[model samples]
Target: MTHRFVFPTLALALLLAGCTSLPAIDPAALPATPAAFKETDPRWTAIAPAEAQPRGEWWKAFADARLAELVERAGRDNASVQVAAARLAQARALLRDAQASQSPQIGLNAGALRQAEPGAGGRGATLVSAGAALSYEVDLFGRLSRASEAASLDARSREALLQSTRLLVQADVAQTYLALRAIDTERAIVGDTVEAYRNTLRLTERRVQAGDIAELDAARARSDLASTEAEAFALERQRAQLEHALAVLVGEPASGFSVAVAADTPPLPQVPAGVPSTVLARRPDVAAAMSQLQAARARVGVAQAAWFPNLSLTATGGVASPEVSDLFKWSARTWGIGALMSLPLLDGGRREAGVQSARADFDAALASYREQVLVAFKDVEDELAALRLLEDQSQAQARAVDSAARATALSASRYRNGLVSQLELLDAQRSELRNRRQAVQVKAAQQQATVGLIRALGGGWS
Candidate 1:
């Protein structure tokens, strides 16, 4: 009896000794990050990245009541966000299923059978049966544990991806709506210029009738008015297109949805840029990448476990009788118990291939995780650069608009006093309109860049 237990005990010890745990993944293994941003404005304060935390109501910082309302609506109604939520739910369910495998399974079964008895001259007899069965895998090699860990990690990955999707949709809504407002502002400018040109045409026509101005002056005024009106129409068309895009983003049909023409761009928010490496912790996409890498590592452990042994226990208890009423009799009681141990002694290299494949998958996940971190840094840098350069452009454009406005006023006065030709006055008017439009466009760009920076910083500064 002692010898009989000795062999199994020695085998168990060998199996335990041979088992391998998953490799540890370190965030520090990724490429080193820069301490400070290369292109940052003096207005932005840089602090070391803090512990990762949830983002706040960052959009509300812009102080636009309408934009705040629209962002809330988009978060609640966006189709892409709904899809991501569904996927996250599915991953959670799958993780639960993996966890259930760790527990013993019990089932009840019932059956009736008719068969000929060999010793009873081929007489047919009906037998009735009922039973309770139990089964459980003894996870001796950690296969089930690793599988459950991988599933749990996968669920976490999905959760992070859902966060990423929500951030993307909200940012897109902000940028699109801001662009529409900029178009409205431009349309208003053109409409005002068109009215001024129309009045100039009427004045020129009256002067021509009184023999005080040439007919060519009236023709030039009419031409300018018509051109300005055309520009206003084009701006209106662009506004319509942007409104349609906003409708789709909010999960509504464009035909049934509308946003009133917004004439004012919201003041840009002053979002500070945190330490450059902090993006790895701040961005949900980066978190998802790391989660996937961890899951892949768990899968590698599961694949390695396949080379070891598996143990299982099963039991059944039942009663059978020719008559249904006798099924529960004391004399009809039956029971059984069993233990099974299986170890793969030989295979056509299938297990080895599985192990190799799992390792390769892990390697791929690691590389992808590294790439995601790099891309996150690039996103922040791109937005920072855009905001910085656009600010400089906006300041210069303001000066240009001021100069153009002064020139247009002086030219108009000169034309009325017969100091300049109609062509020269019209040219001044066109220059003023162009400069003002450019200024508004630059302001709109600065606003768009601010939103982009907020998004690139993972929706908020820490």
Candidate 2:
């Protein structure tokens, strides 16, 4: 009994001695964290906000409850977000599979059989056998460990992707809703302008009938009326299209969805610009890129592990006998254990190729991560410039609208007092109408710029 147990123990010790753990890898070599961007351009220094709220409901800065509600709905129901979530689940399952490879596996077997002999009369010889077997491959060179690490990094990357997609969907929903509101405002303005032109045309016709104004003046007034009416029709079509787009963004059928148009426009939201380095942590795309780099680095370890030997231990126990009734007797009991070592002595440079491929992939991932960082910085810079310039433009447009209003008032008063021709009044009115429409456009652009800045800053992912 002592001898029987001693050999099994010695074999087990040798098996353990043959197995080795993976070498540690340095984390710093993967990729350097991005630094804060410093802009020497006067525009960035002048317009950059001193502080920012990088958290939930960034749209609430506009103080529009409707807009906030729409953003929330889209974040919850958007198909793109659903797809990202599914991909994340798949990555996690893959990670689980990789981790499972690190442990031993055990299974059970049980069966019964009968036998016949040629030299004797055939007889029923029932045989019953039952046993359990275990098999395990020791990761002596860290292959399994590196594979698990890669899988974990892949899961992290997927999670970051999901977050990024959610932010984009939220931004899209808000922008589309804002567009629909802008169209509604334009439609109302055009409708009012069309009515004013109609009244002018009626007055001009009466003057022509009274022989105070030429038929030519009446014809010009009628032409202006038709043009304004056409503009109104075009604006209506644009408004419908914008509404349909918003409906689709919120994952609703376009036919049954329509955004309610309020008489008041939502104020532009205030955006605070934080430090540039904050984007690295806040932006999901940046995080995903970094995770990808980590996964690639792990792949290098996985490839290097192939240069070492693989160790496996297998054990089996069962009972056998010529007669089925004697199968369970101690005389028929048997057991065996074995260990295997497989070293790649030569493979026609296949292992070398694997190592080279993994290194190349790592290099590519490093470059991609760097590019993503540069692009993120560019997005923030562009948005900063746009917001600053658009603010000045909106102010200038406001002044133009005011001046045009004054000109229209003067022209209308002069015409009523018989101090100016009806033609001059019509021209003034058209200018004021155009200026007002342009002002609305400028305001919408300012709102959009604010939205862009928020999105570029990763929609407050931090």
Candidate 3:
């Protein structure tokens, strides 16, 4: 009679002990966000959090068809994006496995045995049994629940990382394609300069033959033509390298892939700036970090719950008989049900170590999350500042190019009229070419900075 009461009393004790709740996590421990970014534009307006929203066709804002196509191709085929997607799939599968642990496990069992009875000497008997068993953990200390939550958060983190990878690939494709276009513009400028030098060389050679100018002037003109041609070749090499990089981004063989030289680079698109909080919420890296932190927090609870008693309920039903004919009889039926409560009395400090390790992971994840937020803010500020300064630089470069062009035209006419020497005409020509190339370079910087701003802002303002 005393033994009959033991199981119920033990179960009651375990249930009461499980009433101990996990400690609450403080949200205030995270870094505080300001209402606006330090460099937020006044024209910027409040927008909804866009992390969950699709950044559909953000590259189209540049109004370049080829760029949009390349970005879309990179999004579909980039190796980094594919790897992140595979990781996300694995995380989801692990989440399903964790959820399965919370559900009852059912299994079928069957066995056949042949054994000799000691009293029967040489006689052998056959026993056959078939059964179904059900087992379930009671989750008395919320360990299973917390484990599932952690798995779910891990899946979310992987998903956010995948989005971040896609965004990165898109930005890379746009920047590379824009760079190639800029090289094309510079190449055109150099090609024109080379032709102009060739013309100057021919005029100098004719004047030298007629005894109007010395051989020295023709030698200088020849040197200028060769150097300008060499510069054009350098631009060609850079354009080829950029094309190869773009091909790799789109998952194509570099040897066979090429982007046609475009006559014009795309105009820089205006990217709006919103509050820092909204930008943080929209960035996938920040989302991934937050998920990691939450997952770590859940794991901490799971580790703490490990110190509590675990309760499991099990049931089995089967039929057993000495003969096959008797196996189906009602008298051969057998059924059993049991409840178990287990608590570790000694573990050589393993439980305490697990709790400590989990807490440490939580702390590390918290730090990582904070760092990611700070970096995200820094990226936005850096790009904003770059675009602002690059715009002013581009305008100033344009003025310089115009002034150089006028000086070169005047010097060329004076040289033809014998009012200026060949060296003066060559100097003005060199100045014009340098200023024009600089203008193209500044324009390219502006385009790249625009793309950087879009990427830093988490894809698009929309």
Candidate 4:
């Protein structure tokens, strides 16, 4: 008995000694990061990235009640977000399945067999057997543990992706709603311009009837009025389309959903004055990529473990008897215990191929993680640059709108007193309308850029 135990214990010691540690990527080898962002504003303060934390209702900072409501609805009902949530759940379940492999398995079975007794000259006998079996595979090489770790990381990646989806949906809804509101304000401006053109046409017609102006002046005035009306109609068409798009974003049918026309657009949300360059790490997409890279690294360990032998311990106990009534008797009791060790000597290079495949997957994941980090930095820079440039452009456009409005007023007074031609008056009116429309568009762009920056910063700076 002592010799039997000694051999098994010696074999177990050898297997334990051969266990390998999982491979890990060296942090020093990863892509270098900047200490500060090029576009960092003076008002920004340095803070660490906290992408794993909950991002509350960031849209409320805009102070737009309708926009806040719409964002909430999209978070709850958006199809993409729902799909991501389902995938996260699946990944978690897979992690549990992988973990189950590390635990012993138990099974109970019962059966009745009818056969002839070999030495009894074809005498028939009935045998009843019941048994309980337990088996456990020792994780001597860490294969099962690495597999579980990979599955856990996969679940983490899915969870981050779900957060990314929710943020995307919220930002999209806010931008679309704001765009629709800008269109409403623009339409109102065009409507006012159309009325002004009509009044100009009426004045020109009166002068022509009195022989104070040429008939060509009256025709020119009429043409200007018609052109302004066409512009107003075009704005109406654009507004309709924007409204339809907003309806779909809020998870409503285009035919059944509508937003009330409002001349007021949502105010731009304020950006934190001092944002740290490390904020890029808070991006959900980047986090997902990092998780995927870790998972791939763990799978490499699992593949490398395939070259080691697997040891399983099994035990069974039960009773068997030819008579059903005697199956459970102590005299008929039977039991067995065994151990198995499988080591494949030749497999046509299948294990090597598995290791190579796992290594390649790790390389791909590493590259993807690096790319995601770069993209996060790029997104923040793009929106920051857009906001800065658009602010200057909007201010310049505002000055142009004011000057054009004054010019239109002066030209109209001069045309009435015969100091200016109808052509000059029409030119001034067109300039005013164009500048006003451009101002509205610039304002919309600024608001959209604010939304983009918020999204790029992982939903909100806080």
Using lDDT as the measure, which candidate wins?
4
- lDDT of candidate 4 over 164-188, digit per residue (tens): 9999999999888889899898988
TM-score of model number 2: 0.82
What Cα-based lDDT does every candidate model obtain? 0.82, 0.77, 0.84, 0.84
Q: Which stretches of candidate 2 lie over 4 Å from their true place?
A: 1-54, 112-128, 208-223, 273-280, 318-332, 346-348, 412-418, 421-426
RMSD of each: 3.8, 6.1, 3.3, 3.5
Higher-lDDT candidate of 3 and 4: 4
Instruction: State in Å the error of residue 203, model 3.
Output: 4.5
Writing each residue's lDDT as its tens digit, candidate 3 over 1-462 gives 966766776676567556755444565765665555556655433243357866667788889999988988888888988999999999999999999999999999989999997899779988899889999999866899999999999999999999899989999999999999999999988887887788788878889999998899889889989998999999988988999999999999999998887778888777554433444457788889989988998999899887777889999999999888888899999999998878787999998999899999988898898788778778877887888888789889989999998999999899899999876786788789889988999988988887887788787766
Count: clashes, candidate 3: 0
Candidate 3 residue pairs in clash (backbone atoms < 3 Å): none
Off by over 4 Å in 1: 1-29, 41-52, 196-228, 272-280, 409-426
Q: What is the lDDT of residue 462 in candidate 1?
A: 48
lDDT of 1 by residue, 1-462 (tens): 966865686487466637666767765767566665667633333333332467887788878888788888888999999999999999999999999999999999999999998899999999999999999998877789999999999999998889889889989988998899889888887876886687678778988999997899888888878887888888888899999999988889999989887677778777554434444356788888888998999999899888777778999999989999999998888899988767776899988999899988998999898898788778877988898898789889989999998998999899899999765776787788888889889988988887887787778664
Estimate, for each residue in 247-303, the C-alpha lDDT of model 2 and write its tens digit. Answer: 777788989987787756788866544543444346778778878888998988888
Worst 10 residues of 4 by lDDT: 41-50
lDDT of 3 at 51: 76
Sorted by TM-score (best first), the order is 3, 4, 1, 2
TM-scores across all candidates? 0.87, 0.82, 0.89, 0.88
